[model samples]
Target chain A: MARVDRSLVTHLPLFAGVKPDDLEEILREARSARYPKNSAIFEQGADAQSFFLLLHGHVRAAKTTPTGEQIVVRYVAPGETFGLATAIGLAHYPATATAVDDSIVLIWPTAAWPRLAERFPSLAANTLQTVGARLQESHTRILEMSTQQVEQRVAHALLRLAKQSGKKLDQGIEIDFPISRQDIAQMTGTTLHTVSRILSGWESQGLVESGRQRIILREPHRIVVLAERSADSGAA
Target chain B: MARVDRSLVTHLPLFAGVKPDDLEEILREARSARYPKNSAIFEQGADAQSFFLLLHGHVRAAKTTPTGEQIVVRYVAPGETFGLATAIGLAHYPATATAVDDSIVLIWPTAAWPRLAERFPSLAANTLQTVGARLQESHTRILEMSTQQVEQRVAHALLRLAKQSGKKLDQGIEIDFPISRQDIAQMTGTTLHTVSRILSGWESQGLVESGRQRIILREPHRIVVLAERSADSGAA
Candidate 1:
């Protein structure tokens, strides 16, 4: 067991309304661990015996098809929870999570969830809210994929990334992590070639800058305009 | 206020592990209401002041595109809850829900959710589990849409519907509700013409029976076969 940090409880969304003493009691059962970039935190279909809270770095949640195609579902940032399927009674992890960078995370055993939930009703409520929010975001992504063109989807994805983890650079707001064109393609439900072409076009038009595994938004509003533009224009 | 049913609490998945007395106490704050077929129970983006539990008949949860195309997201059956978005702190409904047939539902004010959740930890945990399950399903659908061909998508959609609310008929397993070809189109991300043609082909092969507004699966395994078949066959 790791020493419980009173401030860490305040940082986690699930423990928002819980008192520091209550969180300390809960965290007595938790341990802090670190993983290097590209390390598999957990594998798909593995028994979900634990849940995690990221304290630093990024993680990617993904699923793999039988044909070996990988689809990136979500990216977890610091202060967010992962392995939530366990909280919901799932026996196995639905997707594989890999550390995107050197990451520090707080780990909680599955056995502790029910006890903590019983003790602090607010924790349970907050967990439900977190799941609900994620579901809504997933639904929005589904609607976009079903209706929006590829370029539009890419633009929207970039905006979402900006909102979550953007860092202002000399030129514009840059997504503060390493992300390849292929990663964007997977997230946007498009082919890598399509993502590359559209990004190159945007780069030429001064809408964004793309380089070795990074994207910087030169004009965020312009990207929004492109995303909201009618598909009839054939720009997609 | 209608007399609340003590038995109703047992039927709700959210109240699965709750004590009978506690459940009855929660139910005292609920009201039973009925809606005629095709009546809107709630609209997307409406103030989500309450949550509902279906007791009889069926409800369809759907979202409409700005272009006026309606997509059926899911169907709520007896004992299932809708409008849970509000319970999880959403300010408005993310999707509209309507009665597919004359339906009876239990309505609980949003304010009651936190109270009930606090008093019965099981209810909160179950709600979170439901949200998690939906998120997994949505992710699976996204994977299907991105990688699977149209025919596979259709087959998968049918399987999902059957799992949710299929009824055994002389012909096969009927979907247990009315759904237009257009609804199938929206669910499968295809056109009505394409859905019609595919169903017609399936009907000819005795894989399914299609009526004016219902689909009966004659051989569900065949649908599974279609869903699993390689896209290289060009059956789509």
Candidate 2:
């Protein structure tokens, strides 16, 4: 582990009000770890000993069903936190976090969480906002999955991924990392065949382009309209 | 509007760490508000002026689509909180909170949230758990909605409602409050027609009995199996 850049802590909105000395003291017990692409950072049901501050790259936090199917709960982007069982006051990791690419994250022991939170009230305050926003987003997605058709769900998922992990490209907007049809399916709660078919239709309409593992959205606005599709619009 | 029973705040795990003086000071600005059956405590898109602690009775926190269709996001039971836009750092209520039955709640100005939070950091820490748990539940629902059939979804919704507000009756576990089939439809993201058809089928099987805005689950275990159904199992 290299000497961790402490700026990562101070710069975060969660710690913006934190003093330099306080952040340095907090970072003293923290260490940085890296995981290669497609590697598990932590497995589900393991003792949740720590929480993380993502410094580089991407990761997916997922849960597995009894029958061995995995559901992607969220995508961890840079500067965000992941593996939050401790922050949420849980004893074990409820989901597995896997790196989507080679990634780095600052690790803090679960024991330190309370002390840090008590010492810096904003830690808890800002974390509440983060967790609250996630809850809101999750609720919205559930509504979409339940009310909206497959095409709308897929469109909404892609647009969100683009917002979080998308990189602007000359052609349009590109989802910054390698994501498979299976990954999209897992994220949207659809089958790979269904996702593949949807993507194929989008491609023919010049809405998106896909390669082996990359997807580029040519007109994200159109995708938004697609996502906002009303129940009656489909019948029309 | 009456002086809040301070014990309600202290007894809660969310405020376990706060001093009595602090709790009283925080509650000084709080008041109790009541809503009649089916009346809204707060409406979606309205300025988020306050959040609440459910004291008695049942409530439904829902969001309405642009087309005036409502989606039930949560059923607010006693001891839980709702209309938490301020806790999430939002300016307006993202959803509407309405009394499912005649209900009472302790309401506090959203503006006071940050001040009290800084005074008692546990407010944020405890809220993280609440919001995180919600996020986890929403993720599970998204997965279910994506993968499960409509029958499965309806079964799941019933089982959940039973868990939240069920009352033991001579016949079976009666949903304590009056919830219309349309409410079930919104919760499950199905249509009233579909819900009606399924409930009728269950009635014939003696698994459930429905009477306008009321339902009893005679066989909850079978409903659990229905909720756990797999794609292949149905075909088989």
Best candidate, DockQ: 1
Give DockQ per model, in order. Answer: 0.72, 0.69
Return the lDDT, model 2, position B189.
83
Q: All candidates' TM-scores? A: 0.96, 0.94
Which pairs clash in model 1? none
Question: Which ten contiguous residues of candidate 2 chain A have the minimum total lDDT?
Answer: A227-236
RMSD of 2: 2.3
Lowest summed lDDT window (length 10), candidate 1 chain B: B5-14
| Candidate 1 global lDDT | 0.87
lDDT of 2 by residue, A1-236 (tens): 46678756568876767788887887887899989999999999999999998889999988887778877888889989888888888899989999999998899999998888878877787888888888888878777766677888899999999999999989999998788998888888889999999999999988999989999999999889888877567532
TM-score of chain A of each: 0.96, 0.95
**What is the TM-score of candidate 1?**
0.96
Q: Write the per-residue lDDT of candidate 2 for residues B6-100, one digit (tens) a residue.
A: 76657886677777887788788788988899898988999999999998889988887776777889887888988889988899999988898
